[model samples]
Target: MSRSALKLRSWPLTILYYLLPFAALRPLARVGWRPTSRVAIYKSVPTRLLSRAWGRLNQVELPTWLRKPVYSLYIWTFGVNMKEAAVEDLHQYRNLSEFFRRKLKPQARPVCDSHCVISPADGKILHFGRVKNCEVEQVKGVTYSLESFLGPQTWTENLPISKTSFQDQLVTKEGNELYHCVIYLAPGDYHCFHSPTDWKVFHRRHFPGSLMSVNPGVARWIKELFCYNERVVLTGGWQHGFFSLTAVGATNVGSIRIYFDRDLQTNSPRYSKGSHNDMSYVTNNNQDGIVMRKGEQLGEFNLGSTIVLIFEAPKDFTFNLKAGQKIHFGEAVGSL
Candidate 1:
């Protein structure tokens, strides 16, 4: 192609690029666009398949000579601190999963014994407070229904059916209220999660849905973002009342593994959207269900994910965390 002809063709393209931004600034209504429309488009993305592919890619064994360069690049890009890791040698990790699931030094994250509740994993505190109207805030102002996120309370029976809302039903005792905390894990954060408090897990609800990005930035813009993502909700009782911990899957996290639940699987090939599969830990032999002590390892994700804690606590319960604060596992989250 001639130089003059190439410049002539590129001139119009350059003008179009500058004009596109101005056109986009106009009222989206005039262009038949709404922000909510993005939900549908986001849903259309095959994140499950993409995540599965990423999972496979992560498992590819690296050549011994190339491990340091490859892993160091990732460490540098994500700002991963090797000093905190149990294995400081970058070449020691054979695959990405090994590095992501790396154990921290024993003295690195000391669980706070003073508080009633501690953070479940290493991440940033997205939101935390009382759950009012059965709605828990995903971020500052974005909320998702407590029932929708936890699924129907089908396991609990014998309670008198009344006109009381789902949120009200959760509070078994007077002066007790439901509280929630949302923690978002970045790619550089630890992948394993621990039990935030001493609670008995009676039920597990697995909802297979979209593998959307649970990034704080995305959560702020997308309503009910957590509700649509694949999640495992472990529900039970603590000293106060109903308690539940949910692990939310993200775009590239292909798996959510509960160390205790051997049969539980996530990101399955076939699923019925909007319908959840439930597992009852209360069985004939075991009446109390699975017991989780404070700081006990619970589950892990393939990569970074999100953990949502919704439990019953006294009305006087207060949080030690602040919005957008970087937190580590075993750090104090709240106390009564």
Candidate 2:
């Protein structure tokens, strides 16, 4: 589709998304509403089947006429600038999806310094600042608690102290580093996710939920959208603290797959506690931790999606950013 036509098409869909009953949709999600929710007949089967098929097809080598145009459309939709990307040759890609999530040229995004927090991907920074107490500001007059986003066990274990005041200095000396940045990936933006800091990925978890649209408007109107969305959470070990990177899934965005381990596939089943009795068993046994250098590709979100970064308490670093700022891969997000 042409750029103008695509923009025109997105307007009504955007309107419908805002008009929908978001709170009521939460229950349906808890009961298993997902991208495949539309296929009523195959609803009994695992949704992974559909995503697997799509993933396999995306990997199939195809002709340039077919691949290039599809990728061009994706770039146009996401407003991706070819000049900034490492790989600009559209004909070199194997498929539309491959082109959509193409890797950057080595020099395209250079890691700032060993101690710097590098941007995880090439996209626009939705928001970034200190986490005052347990709350994170999504917009003016809108805030969501970090405790609520990370679930009870993880939240309680990670954040033991309560944040009583927002103005009482962002990061205290008590080891709680108050900082987070949310990056939104448009269809044309590079979909690959990278490590923001040098760390060992010790644990990974997938939460099964609905595939709601995560556009800016939807984010403002839909409370707890990021926390409730189907997402893959990756926890990493840093020198003085721990950090998490959440790859949130969106509508028609089949899956979020991490390349940390070759064994983990996008179509794999959700192994959270509620779904399986031995939830910890699976994750613990498969804890073949991998070390990732800053800017190293960790995962990729199929189609387009969002990535949320969480820092442990008493965070020492402060982000040099603001809302709606565009960030490129390998750029310094903050200093330790």
Candidate 3:
């Protein structure tokens, strides 16, 4: 189909696909309805099937004539800047996934050379600050548990208390103080995410949960939104302290592709139902250690999704960020 024809066909479908959630979720959120209620039909099984279908569709190659119009509408709809891409011509990509995971020109995003904490991805900073009482802010008033959010990771057991605020839930065990931030990727933004600092990835954990939307609207309404979603938790640390970078799945996000571990998969049907929370796990321990420099590609969301980073920095560290700030993969967010 031609570009105009494709747009005409796609626009309505696209708008409705997104609008149904907005229409249905907003009111439910306002009324404080649980996300996993009847809404699971929209956010659970069917959405997972849709996501899997979309993933399969993206891999189907179309002829060049059809590709331009289809891909053009996608770029225009998302407002993607082809110039910054490593490959400027959209035709170079074999399929949608190829284009979605396209690399940028090396110089397009310059790495911050100084010793500071950098952004792990190009997206809006939904929340950024300390992990207080073993919880991180989902929105201004909404928060989620570190233990529940990360699932049954061993590190949850050793978190030292630097302070006490929650009655029994040790916020910080003893010497370890945790800080965190949430970065949300919209459809138009760069899809791949990188490491915020030069760090080692010693282990990882994948927790299977709901595939609900992580958009700001859904986040405010859904309790434990991040924890309730399927997520891949990457455990690593710098010289200062331990940290975790969580790749959270959302509606239509079929996969979370990790650069190092190709075996890792997200939004899989195997995890859709049953005792997945207890049965599902992917743990990789690198005794030799897999070290990645600042701005190194860690993984990518097959579609737009969210990344949550949790860590304990040095006593001298201070976050130069706030809620709702826009950030890029190589920009500085804090200094140690």
Q: Which sections of candidate 2 miss by over 4 Å?
A: 1-64, 83-87, 154-175, 262-288, 313-316
What stretches of model 3 exceed 4 Å from their correct place? 1-20, 24-45, 155-176, 272-286
lDDT of 1 by residue, 1-336 (tens): 678766655444222112122223236546786766655566677878877777788799988888898777666556678899999988898987788889989998899999989999999999999999889999998999888998777866632246379988777777788899999998778889999999899999999988887877678777899999999998888888888899999887869999999999888888898989989999889989999999999989988789999988888999998899999999999998
lDDT of 2 by residue, 242-316 (tens): 677878776546567777455444435453522311022124455536777887778887766788887654445
Could you arrange the candidates by TM-score from highest to lowest? Answer: 1, 3, 2
Alpha carbon lDDT of each predicted model: 0.84, 0.63, 0.73
lDDT of 3 by residue, 1-336 (tens): 588876765564355235346445447667777656645545544666767777888788878877778778777777678889999887778888887788899998998888567888888889888777777898888988887776544443344443244312333333546788899998778899998888877666777666677888778767687887788888766766676788998877768888888677677776544223322222455343568788888888877889998877755678878779887789888886
Candidate structures ordered by lDDT, highest first: 1, 3, 2
If scored against the real structure, what TM-score would every candidate get?
0.89, 0.71, 0.83
Candidate scoring better on TM-score of 1 and 3: 1
| Candidate 1 Cα misplacement greater than 4 A, ranges | 1-33, 158-163
Displacement of residue 132 (Cα, Å) in model 1 is 0.8
Angstrom error of the Cα, residue 134, model 2: value is 2.5
Query: Pairs clashing in candidate 1?
Result: none
Predicted model with the maximum TM-score: 1
- Show the lowest summed lDDT stretch of 10 residues, model 2: 273-282
> Distance from true position, residue 305, model 2, in Å?
1.1
